[model samples]
Structure formats: C-alpha cells, structure tokens
Target: MNLRSLTVLGAALLLAACTTPLQPGEKRYSAAELLALKPADLSWPATSTVGERALREAAVADIRARLVLPAGPEREAALPKLFDLVAQYNAEIAAARPLLLQALPTLGQRDAETQRALLTAAHTLYATDAAPLIWPLLPQLTTSKPFAIAAYTLLQADGAAADRLRVMLPQQFPSWADDARLTALMQRLRPSAAAQPPLAELLAAPLRPGFPVIVSLQRPGRQVMGLALVRDAGGRFVRDGAGQLFTSPQLALARSGLPGTITNGNTPQGLFTVVGAGTATNPNIGPTPYLHSKLPVEATPAEFEHVPAPGAAAWDEALYDSYLPPSWRAWPPIKEALLSGRAGRDELLVHGNTINPAYYAGTTYHPGAPQQGCLVSHEDWDAATGRLVASRQLTLAQTYAGAGARSDLAGYLIVVELPGEGAVTPAEAHALVMAAGR
Candidate 1:
C-alpha cells in the first residue's frame, strides 16, 4: 500500500485500539479477559458521549479496581496499559499507588520493557509521590534512555536526585546534547521568575510577511499545555469586544513525553508552514479539520518562507537565526523545532482532541489531551452521535480560512515557549497582541 493508505490504516487501528467499544449487546469482557487480549483487542479506553458520563465512570472504576488485583504476570503485563489509561484520562491514581509501591521491589527481576513501563507509569500518574520509590530503582534501569527519562521526571523533585540526573542526561542521552536546547532544558526545569519582554518583543522576531500565522505560546517547561493566538495575513489578531486579542488554549504535549529533540516528544517551539487543512481519519483527533504544517528542515527555507527556492541552504546556524529576531536568536530554548526537525521529527500539525474531556475534567487543561507533538486545541465530541459539539480548533481553522483566499488554507504556525508556570491567559495574550499592535 502507498504511504497515505498506510497512514489511514494505522490511524484506524489506533482509533480502534484506543476508543472503540464492544458493539451494542456484545459481551463485555471481564478484566482478565481484557488483559488476555492483544493490544488492539483491549477496549477499556471508553469514550463518553454528552450524557453517558456515569457509564464511562463505572467502566473506569472497573479498570481501577484491577490495579489491586493479585500481583503476578497479569498485573505486570497490565501495569503499563493501566498507567497509560490513567495518563490518557488524567484519572486519579490513589488505588494504583499501592500497586506501584508493591512493584518497586521486584523491578530488577522484571524485564526491561516492564521496568520502563513501570517507571513511565510512576512518572505520569504518581509524579513526585513516586520519586522516593523510583530513586532506589534508577540504578537498575539507568542504562535505558526511556527508563532514565521517566525516572528523571519523578526524581527531579528531589534536589540531590535532580543533580544526579542532570549529570546522567548528557551521558545517557548523548545525542540530545548535540542541540544545546535539550541540554539547557534539563538544566532549567523550573525556570527562574525573570521579567519577560512584552509580547511585541517576541513577535518582533521576524516571520515572513503576507501569510496568516498561528502562534502558540507555551511555558518554558515544555509541558503539554499552552495558548495559541491566530493572526491574519496582514498581521492582525481577532479581538474581543474589549479589543483584547482572542486566544485559544492549546495543548502541545506529545504522547511520548520525551523532549522535542527526540522523535514523538513535546511539541517543539518554532515555526511551521501550514501546507493544507482537512478532517483527520484518526479517531483520537475526531472530525475537526486540522492544519497540516511542516517544520524547518522538514521544509526548505524557501518553502518555509513561501518564496521561490534559493540555492539549497543548509539548516545551519545562519539559516536557523534568520527566522528569529537578532535579540532572541541566540536563545537555545526557542530553537527546539529547528533541531527537532533536523533530528527527524515530522508530521506536526495544529489539530483537536477526540479523547473524552471527562478524563481530564479536574486538571488545569480540562478537555484537552496530549497529541503526537502537535498543537492540539480543545475540542469536545459527542461520542454516541459521533458529532462535534464545540471546537476551538474549528475556530482556528475558520480564522485561517477567512484570513485570505490567496493560499486557500496555507500559512504558518509559529510556536514559542514563553517564560511562566501557568497557562497563558487570554488577557495576557490580548495584552501582548495589543502591545505589539501599538
């Protein structure tokens, strides 16, 4: 099959694995049966429709109860999948705490895959709570990059452990060191509260003119969260009645939870060319149309700037700096997408989530889930009817569409990591956009 067909098939299989439930009146598999089935056959990742919250909650509870099941092969095999469900839904992890604590002692005896999964689970579900447990097991799993990264996530909470992991980062994930941004990211986990330049200052970092742009502003930590502002071809922002720029909450967390320097990690902060827009075949993203964008190196500088091909330019220091203002060009954190694309991270886009928002109801970015290194705007879908209810992504697409008919749905997406701990509020975005305008 061709690449496009393969992509469709893969998305279909993933949607089936992650969301499809047993047909009406079909036999509901018991937890044991669920565990015995293959990856594609396990169907506990249920989606809730407009009014079926209770049904989905009960199903989640059933799966949570299995966390305390007798510790053995079944539990070991199920631990990763269970943790994934928890992360996917941002579900409560109180029950799984005991199970994770129980599994700690036997980690050395488990296979590397299981150990890595356990570490990942602890990182995702327990966070700092699992640090104490994970610290003791790191020596056993430090050789594996995935295991080390997951352990580092929890261990970073403890000062001594954080110091140790900082040293190991360069040694364990050596390739990451090639890009100074990845190394700097490890060192600056909790960014100092420095006064940031006005939004006008950041936007002054010159982008090619005459193309609509979607700028996503994220915190320095590269968390799966941020705010996205849309600009028209003439560099105008949509404003609220009060004349503040309209902003949408966008999630930039990648499913892999790795740094952007690696494949399938956090969304890198940089520019992307919006080459096309359309409905996604992937159920995880649902029916909302997404803007297909390509990063630098993924697209040549000519293509990236929407100009005719100049002689083949290398993705070197000069080319990378051309996209940034001279003042901000030397900063390493902002160079993530350039290095990420050079390192082979591709297929990035601005899209919406189909995963049920109830999964993340209590979280800060409620109704938004992590994507595969894409800028995901909040989108609510009625699972029963398979219909879009509300979508910030749609608004974004329409805004881009209305900007100009010249390229029809093509432009640029510039993602920047701002310096802050909280989500970028609409007020903040408005202030910045207005400041830039003035």
Candidate 2:
C-alpha cells in the first residue's frame, strides 16, 4: 500500500483505540464518563463549526442510542446516565423529547423507583425550559410524588404559567389536594398568585412617581447575575453611553436562587413599595439596620421541602425578616396583609452581610453559602482610600430615600425573574415600564 493510504489507516486505528468502550454489563456511559468527554468528542466529525445546540443534540442522540436496552436492571442503570448527560449540556428539550417519549413505555413497565426517575427528568426538562412538549406527559405522572413536588414548585413561582396549567389540566391541580406538603404549598401559593401581577402587566406598569428600582435576576448562559436599575424623576432608567444601566459598583456581591416561590435559598420576585425603616441589633451581624420589608417573609411558604443542610433554618429566618434601608416597603394593603400574617413574610430587607468587613472586602461573600435567600450586599473597607466601600444595597437605600424626599409619592421596588437565556435586559426593563404606561 502507498504511504498516504497507510498513514490514513494508522490514524483510524489510533482513533478507535482512544475511544473508551462500554464497561462490562454497562449499556451506557455513567455521569462521570459522559462529563469527561469534551464537546469535540461528543460532536460529529470533531468540527469547530458545530454550535452548542448541535453539540447537545449529538450527545442526546448518542445517549438515546444506549437506551434501547430492555425494561430491566440494565436499562434502569442506563437511564440515570442519560439524564446526567442531558442535564450537563442543558440540552434543548425539543431535541431530547422524542427520546424521552420512546423510553416512557418501557420505564412505566419497570419498578416504581425507575418510573420516578423518568418522571423527575421530565419534570426537570419542563422546569428548565417551560416547554409545552412536557405538558402531555405531566398528566400521566401527576400521581408520582416527585412529579407532584415539581408541579407544585412551578405553580407557586409563576403566575401566568400556573394559570395556564390550571386551565389546561384541571385534574392535575386537585390530584395533589390530599398531599400535606402540596396542601401547604397551595395555601402559600394563593397569596403569591394574588400578589404577583402578570409579566406583561409588570413589564408595562408605570413607575410610581417616587424613585423606581427594577431588579432583574436572569440566568444568562449559566451564572445568574442581577442588575439593579433606578429610574430618574423623568422615569428613564439611569444609563451610561453604552446603554448599560448605571449599576452600583457592588453588583450582586452575594448570590441567591431564582426569583419566585420562596425556598430558603431563593429570592422572591414581586412589586414592593417601601413602607418602613428600622434598626435591629443581631448578635451575628451586629447592629447596622437600615430599611426592612415584610415581603420576603410573607412570600415564603410556611414550609417547603429543600435539599437539607446545616444553616438552612438560619438562612431562611434571615431572608424572611432581615432589615432593609428606611425607604423600602410595600403599599398599604399589601403591608397590612403581610404584617397581619394574611400574606408574605415579615422582615425582608436590603441589607449587608454578617461577616467581618476586614475579611470580606474584595471578596464575594455568600453568607449562607449554597442557601442564602436574602437580597444582600457586602461592605468592603478600602484601605487605600481610608473609607468603607458601600454595597449596592446601601446605595439603593440611599438613592430611594433621596428620591422620596423630593417627591410625595413613595418609590417602588420591582423584582422580576428573567428565565430562558437573556430574556430580559436592563435597557428593555426601562422600555417595558414606559411602554406599559403609554
């Protein structure tokens, strides 16, 4: 054979040798195994032109091929690995749904544990994308505990989607009436449903004459970053030359879970008008209270199942009743309901961290670590400047207080969640509120 042909044959042999074969009795790759494979390895032909969605699609196809095993231990083992791959890539549900449907019949015939996993994956995909594709499958899985929990979570957090879900599948709502946990969730959800305005309404709503603050916590790519925009008296969001909101230097100094239904670690989203301000002395964080709201506390369900860990109770308590600056509170009726315990939690605040400033400066402080739910910012001591660098929380409190002094109307705080890939931008937020009024 010619040298050119021999070299091509050698390369093919080398490529085959490098590929890891399935383990003994293993029908598919494990999560670790799949995660270890690079995007290039998963993509067709190792081409750089393959986009992220295409790469994810190829991975889903590969995993789906391994799922052909019969309804038994082998297939059951393969299922989790497939799910792990799907989650890692955040695969487009539209591309992955066909494989999920193909596996359902076999999965249903398997043991209850296997069925639960399948349902959980379906619920996850639905939650991740809010895709309608999973709706048809949800009816069948409503009886599953995992599915019920998932449905309750989504329903509590999203007003528009929850309304639609109720209309589309009325039976699914009542199915969980007997479940104690779901019952509690439903009770808490009622108030949230009443309190949360529709997205369109929220987007279009006019800024109260006083200073207006709009906070958008969006999952752009993977990390969720929050942008705080303040409206001038003219009702335009303060922006710089590039059109980015003129954000406080300390932006998202701490992290929280997505906005909506209050989990201990999650920040709740809604419209709040500042009502009262006070100082509270706490042993952990010291005496530095500014403004406080009942919003976070009232918004939280009395009880919700979260992944259990140490410090969860403390984290929830802090988020529910933490202090804010003097200028922040909800409108009268909402305030009364929250205070009376008829609605949301009390003591929610825009506040600083409990950690020592000396150790925390120039560092991202996650007070509750993996489970902090409050809207918190950090204070840093700038040694060179010989001054304390205030957080966005402080800046916002001061800005609103100033705006309140100039106008009779109270300033409003609107927190909204932006889902599904940069769905909302800071500039868009200003346009939305202004357009809503027009």
Candidate 3:
C-alpha cells in the first residue's frame, strides 16, 4: 500500500485497539471510544445558522468532558482526534463570527462564560495552527477579559503583528494611552528611519549560535495562565513538528507566596540565568529522578559581568538587589529590573514536582497549589491504569539538563512578564548573548 493508505490503516488499527467491550448499562463512553471519534462524528452544522449556536455549545461540552477523563494512553490517543474536532469547531466559529458579532452588539450583553469559550477556541486554534481568520476579530473582542488576554498573548508570540496593533491600541485601550510604561514601549515600537527587526528576531538575535534552549514565561499572574515557548536548534520557537506554539501543555505556575507584594500570590517576572542543577531528594516525594535547573537568587554581579545592569530610566532595581546577599551591591539585581523590580524573594528553580503526582500528571494542575518560586512541567498520568505518575515533565527536564551539560549549549534562562499590561521592560528585553571566551 502507498504511504497515505498505510497511514490510514495504522490510524484505524490504533483506534480499534483503543476500544473495549461495552459493559451492560454503562452509558458513558470509554476513553478508547472517545479516541475513535472524528471531527465529522461531532455533527457540527456546516453552515452558520441559529442552530449552529446550540451545536457549538454542545460540541464544546462534549470536548470538555472527554478532556477531563483520566490521563492515559487512551486519553493521549484521543487528544489528536479531539484536537481535530476543536479545529473544526474553531473554523465553524470563525465562519460564524459575522453572525456572532451581529447577535451580540455590546460586550456587556455577551455571556462571560461563552465569551471565554470563544476566546479559548481562538487561542487554541491560533496557537496550534496559526489560523489567520481570528486576527481581525481579536482587536474588537478585547472588551471581554478572556479575549483581551488571548490577543495580548498572540501579539507577544508574533512581534511583527505588533506593528498593526500599534495603530489600534488607542482605540482598543484608550485608558492606557497615558500610561508611561505603555507609552515607552509604543515609542520603541514606532517605525524608525531604519527598519526595525520584529520582536521575535530581536529576542533571538542575542542567543549564542547553534541549539540553545530559551524558556520564556509570559504574563504569569494569579488568574492568567502563563505561556512557555522553546527555541529549538532551528531558531524556531515551536512546540512540535505539528506547527503548534507551546502555549497549551504548560504549568499553572503558583502565585507568589511572598508576603507584601503587589499581588501576594503573583509569580515574579524578571530575566533569570540558570545557576545550578540537581534532582529532587525529598523523602516524602523521594527519588523523583528528573533533572532540575537552579535559578539561584543570590548570584553576585562579578559572576555576570557580561550581563549589564538596567539603565537609569529603568524601574526600581533596588528591590531586586535586596534579594541578593547584602555582601553584593545594594543596587537592584540587574541594571533594568523589568518584572523583577519588585521581587523580594529568591531560590527560583525550573524543576518537576513529585509531591502530588496525580495533580501534576493530569492535563492541568490546581492553580492554588503554592510554590516557593519555580517553573515546573505539566505532569502526565499513566495511560492504561489512569494512575498519577511521572510525566513528560521528567523527559523535558532530562533533555534540558542533558543539553546544559554540553559546553556550547550552556545558556541563560530569562523570565519576563507578558508584554501587554506590563511592557517588556528594558532589563527583560536586553540581548542575552553568552560570554565570548566560553
């Protein structure tokens, strides 16, 4: 058989293996059964009509139910099918946008929950497939909380798009017009006599040549789900070969547990470098063998001579400097304190957790779970037994840690707040080129 035929045959076999004999009176669909479904099976109406609204609602409900099933091979197998269905659902939404806009004349009249669902659909569709149709709707839809968050996120990922958004900002965010931070960033974004590189290119310009991994956490806040992106060897910030951005499959990082902060539970934003590495040794969560990269808060200025401090115009650097040892300079941690300007604590690390395997192993994590200050991988559960266990987080940690062992790949980790509400501060945006002699 040809490749196409072979692929179809393999998929059919995989789907077949996922099924089980039905138990009498068991109304719920088995995980395998769900995996066997296709986008066509969802019965989404082909055309935009009044009936399409109910169909959209019912389809999302079905997707969510299947998503909550115990994480396992079956669930994993089902995700591709589910994702396909989501793509179809999103296309339907995109087609129905004109109707959706006409039906809901004002943001106040739209159901908050439904707006959230549409926002989520747009985010999922764009992040994975780079669906272009949703772009025009994003600017107008920002009146909704969810839509605003997603639009900001999209702008961060595609810096070139910011040029278009700069024009719309005054209309979309009139109140932010006078905001100093926003104004500064807008000025920087203005087209100069000499053409400017896109933000993504500007961020990538500083990296040492070859395959160095850069992990960026954008807009990590109490209610907002932070996004993480990986810069692979090809210099592309992508999740996989499937062309999806690594927005989903991210950890709901803990709110700052630090006392006396703007948002007490907020995750502090800043540019951080990996200082050390190790594995978890806790007895209660004993012997979870994944690699962990340490972001020690107390590194001295002498250690980072290549990295300059923020300029005089930058935000409060003194506060970040306070987190360092007193023996270090009394000034801020970096020359520009960006998100770290207000940071009062340290010992932040990017590591996997073993304390609650079940919670981590599932597709999502409990946002309320506290952390001293760390970036963790989303835990994965076993497919067959539906038991919480070690997940892809361990794999990623191992991969990153292993890469760090190589001399050429040894690089810094920088954390910054998302660029909308908090503009990318000077400290956060500086080129992170590694030391030359190394």
Candidate 4:
C-alpha cells in the first residue's frame, strides 16, 4: 500500500481501539479524552439522534467485526479486548443523559401506560447514572408498595445491603430494593404507612403513576427541605400503622409557609379522604399552593388492584362505569371551596375551573392572571340513599401545566383528619385545616 494509504489504515485501526468497553484496568478514556481525538482517528461515521451512546454503539459494531474472539481463553486475557474502546462507551452514555431528560416529556407521555417501558429504556440507556437523578414519588404512584419500596431503596445512604436491592427482584427491581436489610426496612415502613397523611389518601384511588410532583418545605434557615418523589400506588402503610416513609416523603411534604396556612404544596397532614380530583387550582389546596390538579376516585374494584409496583397498567381494567356504583345514582355537586377528585384528571379539585375565596383572601392570584385556571373541591356527596354512600368524588387540576409560581415558602403542613375516627398526626392538626364545606 502507498505510504498515505498505509497512514490512513493505521489511523482507522487506532480509532477502532478507542471506542470499546474496558472492564477495569484496561485503557479507559474519559469523555474528555474522547473529545480530544482527531477527526481522522474515528471513521467519522454518521451520528445517531440518540446522542453519544448510540454513536459509540454504532461505531463499535463496525470495529467489532474486525476483531476475533478466542475459543476458550482465560477471562483475564480477553478483558482488554472487551474494552479497547471502553472510554468511548462511557462517554457516549454520559452525553446521552441530558438528551434523554430533555426528551422525556414527549417520550413519557406519548402513552401513559407505556411509561414503564420508557423507564426501562431509561434504565438501559442511562444505566447507573439515573440513580443520582433520584425521583420523589407523586401521590398517584403510591399505589404499588413494591415500586415504592424499590424506589426508596435506590437512595441508599451508602452502598450497604440496602443498596443492593437494585439488582435482585425480577432483575426488574432496582438493586437497591434487593438488599435483605432494605427489604426489611420496607417491611418496617409498612406499619406507619397508613397513618402517614399522604399514605392514607394515596391508598384511596392512586392515579398518575410515574408523574413527578415537587414536595418542598422551608426549614429553619429559609433552606427548603424537599424531595421530588415519583408517583406510586404503593403508599407506605400496614394495617396497624407501621411502615417507612418513602425515601424522603415525610421530609418533603412536612412544612407550612405561615404558622396557620397550607402554604405551597405543603398539604396539611391528616386523614384526608381523597375527595376528588379536578383542574389546576392555585392557592387553593394549600396556602398559596402552586396550580395543580385534583380528581375524586372511589376505589372501584378494578381501580383497586394489588400490584407489585404502582403503575398505570394496574388500572387498565374497567372501573365498571357501565354499572351504577352503589352510590351511583345521585350526589350533590361539590361547592367551589371543597376538595373533590376527578377520575380522568387525577387531582383534587378546589373549584370546577376557578379559584376559591382562599386565593383571593391570601392575595395569591395576580389580579390580571384570571385566577390561572385553578379549581376547588366541592362538598360533593351522595345523600340520595339517606345513609352514608360510597361515591367517587372527582376533579382534575393542571397545576404545574400553567404558568404559575414554581416555588413558595414551605412548612410542615398536614391534612388534619376531622371529627370522624381516622388517623391524624401532630403536623396535620397544627398546620392543616379542611376547606370550609362548600
């Protein structure tokens, strides 16, 4: 071959060596090193939309064809070959992260039920990197204890036995949940789950699994304490009140803004029947709360399923809307101030599609903003039967969807369970109050 041709051939070989996986001691290149390579070093092949990882993967296929594996060599000898381009692999994966997160809304919402598949792709695509982006569970996702247990298990204080759960359960569970100790920890959390303010309401018609809800509260220094929990159906609680708080559920939701108001999304703690869900309402659910949705859902046998993890698929069956629910025939429309949940919308409504007296009282609504499309729960109930009736109070709030304040001073507020016999906690009583009946 001519000298120039030979040089070109040599460069191609060198590029091939840089894009594979190296187990440990092999020549691994960090993202910095890969970026420093000459254009000619790599084949300069067309890139994929999947970002760096896909690029590396595509390039690796070309390079691997030239390599030949031995029939039965010792594992150690073949190791370097395995990773000759290890750095490229790592870099590609790293680069793909922001891309994945940016495109998440489109991918995640294309179909709500398919979110798990999207998560799986996220797992395979991002791999270990996803752990740090630890998500806090949204109330709807609390329907599945296993998923909740597994998610909390992800945030191990350190890589203890508790951290190992990510790998054990069906290989589907994050290794963090596999730790025997962590599993025991999850089991321990069960007892306290029901009494926890969020847990009890979460148990009632858990919806919107996998959606993210920001739960934050201001601490002593104006420093906010909060967690972005993922929505799960497996709300933590056992029959007799003993369970673990979701990784940071208590710390995230516990807080108030003013001494006596439900500030921001700081839901007052207490036994709250998830009255119903409805449209986005601000300064309605909590004191000066952000715009959010609400829906009322009575647990239909179909909506109430036992799942290993809380997911939308759990509700794929019929809610039996065709048949009249025992309390189906009649109920008064909830008034504007009450909290009702909307089945389709998956949130507690404060008003049908309007703000409440509280927002006006609190000055949360900007005069020109037209109340920002907030809603309130109605005192909706079925009195037609004369006795207590099982009704699915519903509403839909699109709180985060609108342009509204994202952050507010937070405090440990709780939904105080009123006179009826039910679970109530200290925080709930002190910071929370039921909306004046509609």
Candidate 5:
C-alpha cells in the first residue's frame, strides 16, 4: 500500500484502546475522505508545484518582512492562490467554499454548468438570498453530473440529502490516487443506461454479517458522545475499533483539555462532540480528533500558537492537525442507522461541540464535562449469552473526571465507554457511573 493507505483515519481507528497504546495506522480521515467531504472550499499546505514551501519562500511573497499586521486586503490580493486554498480550508469546508475554488477556472469561462453549481451551493452557504430561479438551477446538476455527485455525497454524509450518486456509482468509489478509477465512477453518470441497483435483494438487509447495534450515551444534551466497538482482556476492544484510544500525553491533554480556548500542548476538555472526520496534519500525532460539517473543519499551524489552551505548556507551537472538535452531537447510538458495512478493526467517531445554547439551556439532559465528552461504544452480541458474538463492536471508555482541571497533575477519569443498549439509557448510564463513584 502507498502512503495514503497509512493515512490518519486508519490510525484513529485504534486510539480508543484506553489502557493500551494507540495502534499504527490510527487516523481520523484521509485526503480522499476529505475530498469526498466537498466542503464549501478546497486548499492544501501549498505544493512543491508552488515551489515556495514556506510563506517567506514564495518568490511572490506578499508582506514585507516588516509589516507587523498583514490583515489588509492588499495582503489577500498579493497572497498566492495556494495560500487562498490554505486559508479557505481553515474557515469552512462547505460546498460554497469548494465551488469558489473548484468552479473558479470554469466560472471565468462562463460555463453554464459551472454557474449552476455555484448557485446551488450558495443557497446553503449564504442562505440569506433565495428566489424563483433556485429551483431551475437545480436541474443543471443532472446535466453536470460531476458537480451533482459531489453535492449528493456531501448531503448524504449530512443525512440531509438523497444519494443520487448511488444512481451513478453502482460499482464502487474509485481510487483518489488512480485517475483511472475516478474516471470510471464518473463515466457511469451518463443518462443512457439503467442507473439503479438490482431489485431481488433490495428490501432485504442483505445479510450484513450483522447490523450496526445502537448504544445511547448519557449527558444526552448537546455534548452527547458516540461510537460502537467492544473490548478484550487487555482492556482493549476485541472487535471493531471506532473508539480506539490514543495513549499519548499530547492526545490525552487534547481529549481532556478545555475546548474553544487554545491551551497547553494539552487539547482542551470542556463539552465537545465529534462533528465530522479528516486527515491528521501532524504525522507524529496518531489519530487526532475527527472534525466534520460542511463548514470549517481544519486548523493551521498558527492556530497552535501562544493561545489559551489547557495543555498550553505541552502545546508544540510547531504542529497542527486537520481534525477539529464538534459543533453539535447526535451521540453514537444514531450511527446504527447511519453506518453500514462489515466493520472490521475500525473506529468511526462522529461528535459535536458540547456547549449548545439552544439544546443545553432548554433540553432536560444537560450533559456536561466527562459525560459530554464521553465516547459511548455499542456492542452487537448474543441477546442471551451477552457474549460479544458479532462483528459490530463496543466503545470501551468514558471521559476523564478532572478533564478540565488545571490542577490534579496526575488526575484523570477512569474510562469505559459503556454504550447503553437493551437495559441502558442515557440517564441510566449516568446513574450507574455516579453510583460506582460511591
């Protein structure tokens, strides 16, 4: 396998192993997965193609070494398109952002298809404006299958749109590296042939070894957590690895660190949820948090600077990860209807920001701290024997007790995901953990 095979999301799959060290190939997401996300914009850390790897290295460097503050529009204009890509990636990954970049070259040519894509994504990105033509512009997506498929994929991930691409990609998603595979999947989008799947096996659940079993998380408010995996004797999960734990001082800090505020080498620990997934920018760091949403889901090196974070002392000041904390949460049990396939050793995290004014202020379950940051694991087992007799696994840990504490040097929460199932619910889960404390 190439470097892409060893990409980050793979490694993240194993970090849920609380007591054990994070396994290799543990990652949050890959470049391909990022592409699939089709955020509002697109960008990278610049390229060898750009030649100038560093901002200063760019032959067309913008700011004079003296300009203390460079937020002026002059700076924006002088910055390389590559930098625009970088800045755009950090702000928001919504379709509008991507269209600004992906459709740029075509827009200059005034391609009708390009215009349609730009407009379609704009509705979601800039919802302020809407009129009679919003409906008509949509039909163009069918004519421009490539743009349509990308849009379809984004919404499907959000569970807000239908998988029209399914009508296009009946075979499989092609390789991101191999140009050939990509072409084949795209070619199938033509209007000539039957674009639907076979019928006989349609309604049936297609003997999926086993379905994704649900698991409710406590602290059921905005900060609710989620995942589905099981454990072994070594205090690790025996089956799937959705909640694999990374046992790094840096990672531990980030997990238990304060949120919104930048802190030490330690990441913050307030209430947070898994929003989406992405590739880790730091190769040294395994399985950074997975960030999602059609909006901003990344961070730049500058973000880790002398900011107020939990592990401020531990903050590297040198590295950053593409991963981000969540904005809202659905909890792990919802994945039962979301994720489908034969789950192997995998850890698919989907979280959101823990503090939501609307949900927390009004909802009954006000999940906070350890409960909000908790990673609920789901296990599919023999209903009777209670033995984890299936493939779907259980998440095996919980949040730290003193997650946000600046004191308690060695303080940490005793972990166990304990995804709620048959007899357990969010309230029940919390009560059990609380009782155990006694």
Candidate 6:
C-alpha cells in the first residue's frame, strides 16, 4: 500500500484499540465470561456522538445475541441493559421479554447486584406483560430481606401494585414500615390526603445560612420539564434583566429514566447543599461548570444546612427532619433525597447539556436532556470552535457566585414536585416568592 494509505490504516487500528473492549481475546464473550465484566467497563465509547451511537447499536446487538443463549449469568448481564437501554437511549429491547420471563423463576438464586438489576429491569418492563412473572416473585424477592428494598421499588412502577405492597408491608416487612426510608417509599406508594404546604410555607422554611437557594419546581410527573427559581441569602428572589424572577428550565429525569430512588434514577425531591462549583469532565456534561451538591446522607445535616448539628451522630432522620418546616416535614416525597442518599445514590449536580440534540429530537424534553439524576439546563455550543455560545448553567453558576458569601460558591438546592401538568411558569414562581416575602 502507498505510505499515505498505510498511515490511514495505522490510525484506524489505533482508534479501534482505544475504543474497543479488551479482554482475553477479540472474540465474543460467552454469557458466563461476560459476567466478569464490570458495569463501569461496559461504558459508552468516549468519543463523539458518532462513537456513542455506534457503541449503542453494537451493545444492543450484543445483548440481544446473548439473550437468546441458554439461561444463566448472561441473562443477568443482559437484564440490567434492558433498563439501561431504555434509560439512556429510549431503546427497549424486543427480545428481553422471553429471556426475562424464563429467568424470573430462578432470580432468587442470583447475587445481590444481579437481583438489583433484575428488579430494576422488571420495573422498567412492568408496563409490558412481565407483571405476572414479577408478581409471583415479589413474595420470594421481598422475603430475601436484603432485596426487600428493590422489591418495594419494583412495585412502585404501577399504582395498581400499591395495594399489594400495602398488604405485604405490615405482614412481610413490619420493621421497616416506620423507618424513615421505608416510610418515604410507602408514602410514595400511597400519597397522603393531607394537602401540600403552601408555596410560601416551604419558601420560609429554614435552610443553610450562607448560601442562596435554588428551588426547582417540577411536575408530579418526573418526565416533564421543570423551572428553577433562585432565592438570595437575604430571602429575596433573584430577578433577571426583565425584572422577573431568574428562572432556568431544568429536567430531572435520569438518563435511565428510573425513579430517583433507584441507583441512577430521576432527581429526588428534597434539599441539596451546593458545596462548590467546577466543570464536569464527562462528555455528556461537556465543559460547563457544574454546581456541585450532596444529598442528605452524603453530607451531615449540620454540614448540609451550614449549621451546627446538635447530635454527636453524623446524621439521623430527625436532624434531616429539622431542616424542613412542620408543613413540609409531614410530606413523604420530600424525604426522597434523604432516603435516596442512604441508598447509595450520589454525584448529582446542576449542569448544562452538551449531548447531541439530534439524538433526542422528538422526545418530550428535546432541547433539554435527562441526566444521571442531576439537574440539566439547556445550552447551545458552537461545535466548530468548541466555545459555549449560550448556557443557562453558566448563568446559574454566576447567580450562585453572586449570592454566596464565601469563595466556595456554596448554596442550597431544593427540588419540589408541584401538583400540576405543565412546566412552572416564571409568573407563578415570582408570585409564590412574592407571597413568601423577603
């Protein structure tokens, strides 16, 4: 071959070496062999949208090819991707049903991580005909004690399953009924008749002393777009050049489209402490500076609220409870961050999207993209020059920096679900802030 052609071939080989998974050999892995691969190792190709799309198609094909194999660990490996695919790419595997149903009977024999994946996938596919297989296993699954959390999470996929969970709760898992985390989940299962505290009440609730608060008001529906309103430390709503409350449209849906309670689900509704600000290294998040924050268990309540936590204990349910007003204290869904943090969810942030818009063009929140349980704002980047043309996240970061007392760019973020069908308007948000007073 000519020197130029040889050089082109060398570059292609180098690219392949960098992007493809390296194991014992280049040949396809058996179901059992693939089990040894860590979930992290199964990540998307770290290139451009083309690379992402290529890996997605290849991974989906690989999973489908393995699904038809005889039932075993391959099924376990394939199971999680069912949820992952739907969550990340909105792609539902057509071949998962038979494999899932066949594997359901023996699901209890698998390990903890496998069980979690199965339960998560079962929840994702619950709307399909997998309910029968899942229902029978709920007793066995919940009885595992260790897996009861996953079982409870699975039931939450459908409201009809709520009654079943209620019946099983007292009998099957009495001890956890009053536990804060379980209580939060149960309240989600069956909402309370008590009314939501007025907007003014939540706004007036005590928060961290030094930082501004960004209140993200989303719809009860997780997928709908939401609005975030910022309140300065002095308790006044920040306004824009238009003299209206400064608001940014944000989406809290997880890339996996799972509920916030799950590992990488939607953004949980509750308080988060914005401890600092920095740019994300993740390609999906691009170069935008993210408002770094922590969930309840991830940071002590004392640290979370920028106050002295009385108890010697790092954090407890009561300490978490103390931050909210009495009205919000009774609300179950508000405890999601506390419970979710305890469940090992972490790394949630407020950042801007750098994902290729073409990928999600027709979706519900097209201009905005779902994150891995972080708050996402819309951004327009000039791809050719790799410069940010416009960014809501940078604007937010500026707002936080402007309001915070310290150099850490610290603040508070409260995510609340409003009882409505549409995005919270600037007028509605401004009026609510006005009612709360400075």
> lDDT scores for all predictions?
0.62, 0.40, 0.37, 0.25, 0.25, 0.64
Compare candidates 1 and 3 on lDDT and give the better one. 1
> Lowest summed-lDDT stretch of 10 residues in model 5?
336-345
> Model 1, range 212-259, lDDT digits (tens) per residue?
778888876555367888787787876657866767788887654656
What is the TM-score of each predicted model, taking all chains together? 0.73, 0.39, 0.36, 0.17, 0.25, 0.79
Q: Pick out the ten consecutive residues of candidate 1 with the lowest summed lDDT.
A: 37-46
What is the overall TM-score of model 1 with all chains considered together? 0.73
Best by lDDT, which number?
Answer: 6
Runs of candidate 1 exceeding 4 Å displacement: 1-77, 90-92, 98-117, 136-144, 170-176, 179-185, 189-198, 220-225, 239-244, 253-265, 297-303, 306-314, 342-344, 370-373, 380-386, 420-423
Clashing pairs in 6: 87-255, 87-256
Over all chains combined, what TM-score does candidate 5 have? 0.25
| TM-score, structure 2 vs. true | 0.39
**Tens-digit lDDT string for candidate 6 (269-309):** 99888776654445566555667778988776566766565
True lDDT of residue 121, candidate 5:
35
Per-residue lDDT of model 4, residues 285-304, tens digit only: 21111222221132322233
Q: State the lDDT of candidate 2 residue by residue for 53-160, as single tens digits.
A: 344445545455544446655555666445544543344446555556666545424555555555555544444443343444455553434344445435534546
In terms of TM-score, the best-performing candidate is: 6
lDDT of 3 by residue, 121-196 (tens): 3343443233253465555564424444344445545767677767766667687534333332344356335322
- Could you tell me the lDDT of residue 132 within candidate 3? 50
Error of 6 at 327 (Å): 3.0
